[model samples]
Target: MSVAGEGAGVDTGTYRHAMGRLAKGVAVLTTTAGAQDHALTANSLTSVSLEPVLLLVCVETDARFHDAARESGVFGVSILAADQRALAAWFATPGRPLPGQMDRAPHHRAESGVALLDGCLATLECDVRDIHPAGDHSIFVGAVRAARLAADPKAALVHFRGQYSALT
Candidate 1:
């Protein structure tokens, strides 16, 4: 391992290997702009502040949803429940059959017009506060406009060591 303060030795493979062991909740990030909807699976959701109800979700710069998010200035996050692994996988897929991925699943729109997936453990409608470039992704800082919890509670879907598991 490299010494602290020195950016040597650790490569992308090594970093990914280490981070892959961390358990993380999965969520689908969605945005709609110019009459088009986009969504992508992400595990990089986190609350940045509570006073303003701010949160952040990182989107790959190359993902289809990236431009839509930037243009829309609003997005939605649907935290997947344990049984929604298929939904998570579907959104994560690249070049997925079109007619739109949302067509393959049930979803609703937030007042801001962001698509919120049905059957999620929780959903948050957010307005983009800022965007920061980070490595190969862009971190979107959002202020939560509205939040909702599923009618029924269920275990969460988590990813660890390249696999999915239920947080029971």
Candidate 2:
């Protein structure tokens, strides 16, 4: 049965309303596994810790790349700049070819050889530390092995209420 229904008279809308109140920064989660590259635009990313350099990204349980992400053991988190709206759309749309997919986006591979997107505000190369199943999603916790920030400051692209917006 239904896990949420197990509780007596729980208001499901409360969960949705609470989540809607939380603002999140958008990012592109990328990985190369089994001779193919996969990227998805995601807003479900956040820093979990600093002492051990941990971050987390949540992927839908039925996403096409979910298995790849699980098996690859590594992934890249690219914080999209405000100017990269097109890039964000490209990755977010399934069955659409990524622009410049043929040519690497001025990136160097991590030790795991996962291609990280370039020209981002920041990039984190990480090794998968744990995967926790959360509702209809899988939360992948990663240990940051390498990271770099752009020399110049730039606004970040954010997704909210089903649209892409830029920081002022």
Candidate 3:
């Protein structure tokens, strides 16, 4: 372990240390506002409730999806399969051109008209119910309108320490 503020280590050590201890599952968040569709890779998603089918996804304040989520008022979460490292990377890249960018990814419309990735382990269509302000991020509370799981079991893609990996 490195000490801080005594010429022992860099200031970035704390951030790296914190990330090192966290293990997260990767998911692609998709939303369409008007005629524009937006998708971003995210790991900050969690199930908030089972009784009413609620989920929470955090979006960075500056992310393209942040405003899209608010305007669209609906979104889809696609839990990426283990083999989808390329998809995860493609969505996570910053400043990529957007028109028909993800056309190659197999997708279908959910009940809410949100584009859901076809080969994912699971997909959830949700309506934005509440928005909470978190530091540097917005926590979106969504009520699940529809959900589906793949018929065949598949390993999940995971993200940790800024790397994409597979759950064993």
Candidate 4:
């Protein structure tokens, strides 16, 4: 008896549309290589193991952030607040310039040496614990070096149904 989720029968477009219903918090993944900084907007971040304090971010193979994350061996996650919609969209843009891109926003360095955007609802600094390639994207597992709550926490920014919304 084949189930509804069984292979080939599920079309990619349909699968994507179905998953779009999942409301997820939006985060900006950041890394630095030498003097250069790279970042990508990701909603694929999820807590993996509580004992080890691990989290993972899925990055496309061709994305610039992928290479930076691997090489730096460290990264930062800034959980955007509702007021940070513009910041989220800026980092999400494709083919944006690498240099001076970071200057476009206000941020500070985490202990892990990665940039953490200011005005976020929360922040996490992490050291790369492991990496696994899954299909078109690579999952980078991070061991939390430090986690912090905003000085004044605000509503979370969420992505659902191919749009960004405030989770108030």
Per-residue lDDT tens digits for candidate 3, residues 32-125, read 9877889999998999999988999999989988998899999999999999889899999898777886786889988777789988999999
State each model's C-alpha RMSD to the native: 3.0, 3.1, 4.9, 3.2
Candidate 3 C-alpha error for residue 6, in Å? 22
Clashes of each: 0, 0, 0, 0
Better of 1 and 3 by lDDT: 1
As for model 3, its CA RMSD to the true structure in angstroms is 4.9
Q: What is the TM-score of each candidate against the true structure?
A: 0.93, 0.84, 0.89, 0.93
Q: Write the per-residue lDDT of candidate 1 for residues 67-94, one digit (tens) a residue.
A: 8899999999999999999999999999
Query: What does candidate 2's lDDT look like per residue over 1-168, in tens digits?
Result: 247556467677876666766666778888877788877889888889999999988999888667788889889888988888887887787776644562634566767787777778998999999999877899999999998889995888887666778985
Ranking by lDDT: 4, 1, 3, 2
Worst lDDT run of 10 residues, candidate 4, spans 1-10
Question: Candidate 3 clash total?
Answer: 0
